[model samples]
Target: MADKPSTPLLDTVNSPAELRALPREDLRQLADELRSEMIDAVSVTGGHLGAGLGVVELTVALHTVFDTPHDRIIWDVGHQAYPHKILTGRRDRMRTLRQKDGLSGFTRRAESEYDPFGAGHSSTSISAGLGMAVASDHLGTPRNVIAVIGDGAMSAGMAYEAMNNAGAMDARLIVVLNDNDMSIAPPTGALRTYLAKLVSGPVYRGTREAAKAVVQKLPPFLHEPARKTEEFARSFFTGGTLFEELGFYYVGPLDGHNLDDLLPILENVRDAGAGPILVHVVTKKGKGYAPAENSADKYHGVSKFNVITGAQAKAPSNAPSYTSVFAETLIQEARDDERIVAVTAAMPSGTGLDKFAELFPNRIYDVGIAEQHAVTFAAGMATEGMKPFCAIYSTFLQRAYDQVVHDVAIQGLPVRFAIDRAGYVGADGPTHAGNYDNAYLGAIPGIVQMAAADEAELRHMVATAAAYDAGPIAFRYPRGDGMGVDMPERGAILPIGKGRIVRQGGTIALLSYGTRLGEVLAAADRLAALGLNPTVADARFLKPLDEELIARLAATHDVVISTEEGGLGGFGSHVATFLAANGLLDGKTRFRPLMIPDRFVEHASQADMYAEAGLDRTGIVNTALTTLGYDQAAMTAALAKI
Candidate 1:
């Protein structure tokens, strides 16, 4: 455990009410203490560090200025909500963050009254806040609704959509644009560039105060013209005129770290009677910590670390991560294929495209936090005869499903979908889990869906996707390091809809997909010890499943167990459907599909989550033994031994 930081002011406040009671001048000290406490807690827990550090003062100011539980404050992306959580009643559970049965890494509505909206993925806060604002007005309980959205989140179309609607409706909503100039990666798109110009412009620095004073002093008729002139001049020099055109009353590129500036502005906005307003505040990603500020990514997400040195404590792994393998293999493939290009929705490093960008900078595109745009953009690229790989997290791909179905699948475009984090991602919890990708993508016709059994297989899958130019193809892989397999120098594209048998057996067969191959093999070894050798085969492609191999396995084996690291309606469901249609299961061939249960698995270690879902080696062994009519006592004893 990391040494606990002394937080005398923070210790006094257990809830937002206490924070609200504190003197305005004392808030600076409270903010410092709160930041220190958050750092210390996160040092032990290992979650989002930089975002929370950046918003310490902002979080403090918002809580102090507003009646939180009643006045809805929705945090966009929620990675920056750790300080908010601390300032609320969850300070005691700070050390238990992201753990099983603990506080979520992202803001969860069920967890707290203060978190009015749940969020994991970005760019929904404005919409949620608008809904709350409208609801409050309808209920006749006039409460302020503030949406704190990052500049990176503004890159998404949803933010603009909400903004346009809110502006049109003329609802009393406050949008605090937290412009840190960085998301998970340095933000992409024109908005970031515009914000950069706005921050650097002389008009923003010099005339903002003068313009505000002039507008205040002018008559009612002159106020509109004067404000318009100021807006036009600022737009000429900076670029906030677009926001004003959207009908939001735009105010300041204020220093977000300065509580003196943030508090007064927030109080004014809270008290003001007007339509939708946007307060643009500039903040550093890692404001207080020198080491975090000095780091390239501003130490955004971190593992448990040494607080004194700011060195994260990541466990050493000899194996390369699945993400790294994908990046390297894609790079190798791109070297040979000149038409091959990559696209990511603001996750260059998260998707391992940073490495790809380093080698082929021109070939890779970092589209901001816009998954829908990323998909359609890739489809457009594919239409132009370019091999476009739309690399996205499995969970995030859910956001672009309409595009995947309409643009890619309908058009039969050869857009390669490289899906990372294809299973239960630990710590991030159910919201970020890549559980539904297989099921969702499998439901779409004319799309080849594949899952890798191991790192080496991932290489082959990457090559397969790259080579596959017939239609849209997707390959899913898990979150962490590979199973220390010897990687090939170059990947060979495998035959479509093909699978390979690792071990041939008699009584039973284990058909595995994705990373569960290791567990299946382990279970097979355990079954071998019990004098029951089960056949193990890796079903590489889920869509065009190896029907021939599946038929033979079902016919020959007494029991067929299909296993995958995805939800119920995924690879296992597909296999079951194929077998049922073929009349393969009418005979003595008893079938069992092992997958993640219907319920959302909570935050836990990957191993623990798998065990809970009955997908681990022990679980597999137990399932196999029970399916083969082993007695309860015998099964329990066997499982205990395993």
Candidate 2:
């Protein structure tokens, strides 16, 4: 573990109440100490670093200015909520961030009262905060509802939709547009800070309200001109023309890092008589730490790192990552096909499309933080006879489910969905877990769904997705390094709806889907030692089920087990349905399906989560042994060996 930083002021303030108790002048020192403490905790825990570092002052200011737990502050996506977590009496538990049964990486409503809304996904703060504000009005318990969202989050249509509603409703809500990454409105130093304070203050707000009241009394002809003049003057200086048009009284692009600037502006907005207000505050991504500040992508996240050197500890891997393999394979496909284009929702690097962009700059489109737009945008390209590859994480694709169903699936567009981050994502927990794609996509008709069993299989799937221009086709792959397998010269397309039998055996048969084939093979070895030789088959395609291969396995073997790294209604359910329909499960062949359990698997190592889900080697072997009705005495001894 790295050496801990000294945080005397931070140590004193465990909660926002304690923070509010501190003198106004002592806040800058408190902010400094808070920054040091956050850096120290995250250095050990290894989570979202730069985002939290950027919002240290803002977190401090909010906690200091507002009555947190009473006054609702919703952090959008919660990338920058680590500091907020620390200040809200969770300082000691900060070390356990993102671990199993530990504090969540994002703001969870169950975790603390300070977190009014649970925010794991981006661009949801505004909508959620609006609901709370409306609720407060109804309950007659007035409290400030503040939604702190990054400027990048504003790219999503949901944010604007919420803003439009808030404006129409005229709800007493405060939106702090954390203008950090996006260059929406650059801060102009002291002048910008002054304007923000002036506009947010009672004097300016009262004057504006009075003028509006007087304008209402005037003739209907002059109202339009007066409103336009006032809007134009304010928006020109504050750069919030769009927000003003949406019915929000806009503040400034003030310095987010400056406690003095942020404190008064937030206070003004808090005490203001306006129905809805939007404050724009600008800050650096990696505000305090030099390493994150100097690094590219602002060192957004990191593994366990040395505090002094900012050197993250990465485990050495022999095999290439599934993402890189996809990128290389996609690049190869693009080289042959000019029509092949890639699209990502603000995740060029995450999807390995950054490398693709380097090779074919014109072919890659990164629609910022807009998954719904990204899906429909790719569908538009496919309509024009262009092969569009929509590379997105499985978790993020949930946002564009409607687009997948209506735009692409219903239209039968030949859009290739390169679904990354399938199965259990270790530290990101259930929110980021890509477990639903198999079931979600499987439910839709006229679409080809597949999962790669290994690195080489991934290459083939990429090739298969690229080659086929049928309806919509999707292939799922996990997050980490692939199983070390020999490289193929080029991926050759495999026959659809067919499975390959890896090992042929007698009584027991194991049919695996996706990466769980590796675990099934390992379980088969252990079963072989226990006087049971099982057949192992990799079911490559989830959709267009391998009817012939599956029937053969069921007819030949007495017991067949179907395993998948998905929920109940995924590959296993599909296999079970096929067996029941064909009367395959009526005779000697009894089938046992293994999949992720009904509940959400929390943050843990991939190996550990699979074990818990009963999809690992030990879990599979134990399941097979129990299903075969092994003697209790014999099973206990057999279990010890495996």
Candidate 3:
């Protein structure tokens, strides 16, 4: 681990109150110190480094000007809240970030009072801040509410919805637009272009300030007309006329890195009167770090690294990641299938569509942080006879559920849903976990849902989705690397709604879904050693429910354990419901469905989380033994042997 950087100025400030006590001139030094400390802390505990680096000055300015814990300050997505966390007295625990029982990578309401609202997703801060502002109004309190949102997050329709609502209400709300021109990937759509134009236009800074000043000095009756005149002229100069029309008192495209520039603007906005106000502050992602600044992604998310060299530490992987496999397979399939096209909601790289874009740039589309738009756009393409694959993360797909139901499922459009990160994603925690997709998507009638047991299986499922044209079809794969299985030349589209048996046994059967097949097979091997060989099968399709295989297992075996890396109402629940409804549970068959517990799992290593949920190898063995009526002592002894 790298040694902690010296932060002499930062040492004195343990809290935001302490920071607020400092003189304005000394704030520059404090901001520099904060950036260094953030870099050092993230060097030890890798996380969202570039975003935090970008927000150092803005965070200091906000904390210094506003009263936190009392005055609400919400960070959209919360990836940029590391500096906020340090200033809010979490510096001591900074090194333990994103670990088991440690500081969360994103903001958590339970973690600190300063983090008024928890966030791990984007475009929520403004709505939440507006709600707080209205609540304070109702309570007759004079507290200020500020929401800091990035430009990339602005692409989502929800941000505009909140802005429209806040504008209409004329609420006393402050929204600081952190236009860093980046959000994981380079931003897309007209919003990014408008922001860029706003920052680059020479008339934006001086002309807008002069207009505000001139309008303030005019007579009370003429002030409204003069302000309107200035807004029309400013719209010709800068592109913020849209914001003005949205009912916000639009402020500048100021320098976010300069405390001198940021402090006064934030202070003025903090002291401003009624009506929703927007202060646009321009920033550079990975501002202070040279390596990150030079990189295309600006090291948006990073691992522990050397401070001087900026070389991040990465664990060596023996196999390709599930994401890469999907990308490669999709690319290969697209070569032969001219009708195939790809769509992603501003996550081209994360969903591996970046690689697809390289091969078939015309076929791939980035819909810009609008999941609903991405799904519907794919549905539209499907209507035109194009096989559109909507590649999205499982967690992010939740935002477009209505579109998935109404646009695709209801119409029975053959839009291929490539759900990446379908299970518990490590570091990112519950907010980004693809835990609920199985349950949610399975409930929709006529939609085919499949979960890959490994990397090779994922390739086949992708092919399967591409080949199937009946209705909406989705295939889910977990985050991280493949199981090092031998690769085939190309994927073979498997029989839809059918499962294949991997191993044969007699007394008990383990029906696995998604990536849990490895652990199930491991448990099967252990049971075989103990003279209790169990049948092992991978139920690839969750929605179609592999009824024949499931019935055969239940009838032949004394016990059947259904396992999946999903929530309570997911694959396991579906299997259990099917078994009970089909009278498969009426005989001597004792069925146990192993799944994620009905509670939100915290940030931990994936292995530890599965163990905690009792879904690990030992956990599965224990469940089988206990279900077979083994005594507590025998169960413990059997587990100990494994």
Candidate 4:
């Protein structure tokens, strides 16, 4: 018992440098302790578990080799940066990971000198590292810039664009392709097969370097011809022929876990003085832990869990989440309509398409992390008279904004966008928060946007998207459970560009959209207590908004308050625009647009997140009272009556 209480490995590690101070035999022990510490920290404060676990050895080796603060190392998506953060000075604060006013889940530039560029979304590392390398060259500071990107992120076009540009400029950048064979889920596309070949093959690495050296040693006049021959040889060997064409001297298919292999190769690449070299390191997701290794995706981003059992600590939810609801709804529709098909960008389970994929494997398209391709592909599917439902997270959809505007909206394709996580995502932090979808998406022409108040409404929205044969339609829902509303056994399509008046009132009208409708109802209850009968209207369709309802509400009610959980240019802003344009918001009529303040919302619990944004019940009541100039005494008395 006395011996169990004290662990030498735990005592020895204070930082990465200290870990590096240990012997080769002791370093493996240190890694074990580090992984244990990570598991312990994350079990208390839930976050990305499998990714960090998978990259433990790579993290250790990289820190052991590179001088971090001097040599820029950027982690793509930053979910796996927890280990990096712990290795770097933030170990003690591991318990505060993703908590409010604590350490961010992703790499933050402001957090420490070690973090070069902040990232949350995937596939931005290579481009950022290239910029750093170019800047380093220009400033006469030749520091090594490294981008460690996962295979899932490799699917995004931005990575290719970055690789293309970096290869063209011949920037001194080292891209570590951490192919764990999983990125959120198993990566998709032709590149995945190419990666599989590279990771599995043995001969690609040994002969390529010798061949490249022979080419370099040739005469200056024969260099171009020799280079082309070497290029053809690389194409034949690695089959990243495209990468060779882009100008990168591709290396690896190296064993990421084995420090013996990784360290030497990294040193060789560092010494070789190559231009924008890609070091493909193959790794297994959830390498050390049996439970995580067995089910990597399930453990990918876990809630607070029991260390012993690997069971989530949180109680099982009574109500189904919006994602599960969407999945079931899509399946029901697909069963009836042969044309209905579902598509996701490497998120079959996260987007709730796993069951759908299982049901109709051929109909489902898991397009890796390529959101742009997913949208355009769906548009192409729609053009051929197939009902394509492009289910994507709101934050990821930001990546495909150009595609949404150009392919789906402009072409008037009937591609259904099931935008999930359209509000404050708690622990994943601001980078993963889906706050701006409505505002940006609403600006697109020939596009219809709808927000569901609950699960039943989401089902209805799905039906609406399916039934509508004209143009693109987007329906957004929040992350968590529904309002316990009874779901329809079968979905029925609702009218396009129309709203439903949930509660009827007299002088004051509350126009709400999306999940904020719940808050509006709460405020309406308070108003009712004040003997102020407020009309509650759900503005279902954002574009081609219920103008008749707005006009009537403006004329009938003494004041009209528009509410939404999105930033300016969202539902509330659009309502304000409509009212102002129609001369409805005059000195006579009081109109207040209650929207999320124009700013970035940091990580916090959903309730705290909403309260901070002033989108809660109390905030709504305060806004109502302020607009009406009601005193505290009057408001309190009114509250008592309710």
Candidate achieving the largest lDDT: 2
How well does candidate 1 match the true structure in TM-score terms?
Answer: 0.93
Tell me the tens digit of each residue's lDDT in model 2 across 1-642.
556777887789988999999998999988898888888888887888888888889999998888988999999978789999989989989999988778889988778988888877899999999999999889999899999999379899999999999999999999988888765779866887898999999999889889999999999999999999998888888898999889998998898888878888888888987489998888788788999888737378788888888888889999999999999999999999999999999888889999999999999998999999999999999999999999999999999999999999999999999999998898888889998998999999999998999999999999998889889999999999988999897898988878899998989999999999889999999999988999999999999999999999999998899998888799999999999999998999889999989898778888889999999998899889888888888789998875
Per-residue lDDT over 73-98 for candidate 4, one digit per residue giving the tens place of the 0 to 100 score: 89997987887988888887888988
Off by over 4 Å in 3: 182-228, 296-298
Against the true structure, candidate 2 has what lDDT?
0.90
TM-score winner, 1 or 3: 3
RMSD after Cα superposition, model 2: 1.2
The TM-score measured for candidate 3 stands at 0.93
TM-score of each: 0.93, 0.98, 0.93, 0.91
User: How does each model score on lDDT?
Assistant: 0.88, 0.90, 0.88, 0.83
The order of the candidates by lDDT, greatest first, is: 2, 1, 3, 4
Residue 219, model 2, lDDT: 100
Instruction: Compose the digit string of candidate 1's lDDT tens values, residues 167-202.
Output: 999999999888887422233344544554454344
In candidate 2 the C-alpha lDDT for residue 116 amounts to 82
Summed over model 4, clashes come to: 0
C-alpha lDDT of residue 318 in model 4: 72
TM-score of 4: 0.91
Model 2 alpha-carbon drift over 4 Å, by segment = 296-298
What is the Cα-based lDDT of residue 387 in candidate 1? 99
Error of 2 at 475 (Å): 0.4
Q: For residues 1-642, what per-residue lDDT tens digits would candidate 3 score against the true structure? A: 556677888999999999989989999998888888888888887998888888989999999989987999999979999999999999999989999889999999999999999999899999999999999999999899999999489999999999999999999999988989732223344454454445333445446677779878878899888877877765554457878899987666666787766675676666556778887777888988898788737388898899999999988989899999999999999999999999999888888889999889899999888999999999999999999999999999999999999999999999999999887888889899889999899889999999999999998998898899999999999988999998887889988889999999899999999899999999999999888999999999987888999999999999999899899788888878888999999999999999988888899888888888878888998899999999998877876775
